[model samples]
Target chain A: MADVEGAVLTARSRVEVDGWQEAIRASCQPLLEAEAIEERYVERCIEMVEDEGPYVVVAPGIALAHARPEDGVKRLCLSVVTLAAPVEFGHSENDPVDLVFAFGSPDSTQHVSLLRNLARALQADLADKLRTANTVEEVESLIQGIVQDVKED
Target chain B: MTTKGNPEKRLKVMTVCGVGMGSSLILRTTAEKALKQLGLEVDLEHVDVSSARSIDADVIIGQAMHTEEFEDAAPVVVTISDFTDVEALKGKLKEALEAQGWLT
Candidate 1:
């Protein structure tokens, strides 16, 4: 109940990056700019990918970036980043990721419920359509649909 | 009976990730489901990667690059590049646990 909710994003409509760090940094900009999270949280997310390899791709094209709240978190929020060209997160067998959803939660318990909703939204066929979307509006609409679904549930 | 072949008792497992929020949770869910299907009742813990070096668990599952960070702390470790396929994940984990005499 920190008054933080999910936001639909159009900022990551056309991100092209060489590495996983760049991809995470580029994608999480919207959340970082909105004061949705501490500045270091962005770096922490990138560091997670760098140190652990890319395990963010929960499903094809969609990747969720996160780290511990204790690292630096002021609010509970969600931001979406959709890449123009899918970038590799070091997972050799899986396809490159275009969607990077960043989360900033205040606690572990809050994170589980929030993440569960996002995962369910992304694992479905609807997320597949959003992955190949051509316009920012298309991406925004897809995120809107998912957020609404989460609210309803 | 533990699928790990250790009839003595089933092993407790933990999966740590960067923040224990996003990908880590997903991995935990997948891992728990996979272990259950194999008849292994693993106790999965979601710990932040930063503090993983301090937490105590029977076996730690996480990204390969981070294995070294917890190598000294955890007795058993299963570094996974991908958990998208549960069968492949179980196979790798089985091998690790078996080596520890926790699995058959």
Candidate 2:
């Protein structure tokens, strides 16, 4: 199983930009600015979204954006932004992604583990609560619940 | 007397991820099913992405982020979102193999 640290789920709670790239960048920029990840890594994450159209939606309402370590990843952080309204990705059952989780890992091996663990955790009802969260604290609480569950398990 | 009969060699594939479990294994199973439908016999293995460079296979499949590791080893690489979307992945595998002329 992948080692999952409790995500710092930021209460972005909405798409603040027009296009998908802009929205992802908006969601990711704060993490970069806080030194959670390097700036170049954000660009690569955006590129992955543009290239693949959000194939990382492991479950309903949750989408994980990531790329290779060489794309300039510096740290491991799970930054999140929930849209007030989900956005369209122009794919079947892929649109309306309410929760955007951006993962930045320096190693591909680590990333796969992370993806697996994350997918497992999100498969629960807590992920659904996260989708409908109205406040940042509510989102944080949901994330905390998952973190606790992960630890206990 | 010259021997002229030569059987076609089976294609080999490796689907790798962080661990040889979970989604990676799911992907491996999906790839195997797809290749079988394509009438290709494959030798498939599941390993960590770090060991991907050492694995000997004709194609390596994984998330797009890990593409660089297998860039030199696997002549055909298919990077998709996840292996859950069997139809989409089938299309991607077909495209990759056909591009490499590995498809009959």
Candidate 3:
């Protein structure tokens, strides 16, 4: 997993979007601005949702949007977006997502390790908490808290 | 060994995501957690949904979007929506296993 020592959490912790597409854009724009990924990566994420029907919605209220690295990735990055209200991803199993997480990597392997670390945080109810957070700092604190717990463990 | 001669053999479970990184990894973790809660240890595989053709697992666990990809390859397919819900996942996994005679 990449080092989180100087990592930053860039999320639209609280925002309202008209629909899932907006949600996806909002979630990934931060990574785009940070130069962690190219605009095409964000577009690819949307295209995937349009083609695959929101399969990225992993949990009832969480959507982890991403695309192939070759689509457009400059660096490894993650962005979180929490909608003011839930938006349907048109899937029966994992729809009505209120928290969207967009991620990017230079390749599959690097993303896997990053996700492995994220899994630890998510398994600890990180997404569930993100639903109610009102600020990006709160989101950062939640993620940092996970890092602290991991270190303690 | 195909384990065909033994009735106690475990089933192979596979999970897939579009990139085999983001959603797949998340669901994989959730699936493992559910398996642990069920107190059943098993072999699981993860793959990119695009490469999901002719998989070798007895059971494949993934989102509903990938169900069609394994229409003829796998013997059992379990599609999930809420990977975070371990209780639901355990119930579904048990059902999939029992349906395929992998669970008694």
lDDT of 2: 0.62
Q: Give lDDT tens digits, candidate 2, residues B1-104.
A: 11113245666788776534434554665676677777777788777676777777777887665665677777788876645455666888888877766664
Model 1 lDDT, residue A47, Cα = 80
lDDT of 3 at A47: 96
What's the best-to-worst order under lDDT?
3, 1, 2
Top model number, DockQ: 3
Give candidate 2's error at residue A1 in angstroms. 9.9
- Candidate 1 vs. true structure, TM-score: 0.69
Go through the candidates in order and give the C-alpha RMSD of each one to the true structure: 4.5, 8.5, 2.8
Q: How does the DockQ of candidate 3 come out?
A: 0.64
Contacts from the true interface found in each model, as a fraction, amount to 0.37, 0.00, 0.76
Candidate 1 vs candidate 3: the TM-score winner is 3
Positional deviation of residue B39's Cα in model 1 after best superposition, in angstroms: 3.1
Across residues A1-153, which tens digit of lDDT does each residue of candidate 3 receive?
344433434677777788888899998888888888888888999999887777888876888888888999877677787788888878776668888888887776665555666777776678768876778788877766755654454
Candidate 2: stretches off by over 4 Å: A1-9, A111-114, B1-104
Give the Å shift of residue B31 in candidate 2: 13
Residue pairs in candidate 3 whose N, alpha carbon or C atoms collide under 3 angstroms: A93-B81, A94-B81
lDDT of 1 by residue, B1-104 (tens): 35344456556677876666677676676677677766777667776677766677778887665565778677688777554456667888778767866666
How far is B27's C-alpha from truth in model 3 (Å)? 1.2
Scoring each candidate complex against the real one, what DockQ results?
Answer: 0.28, 0.07, 0.64
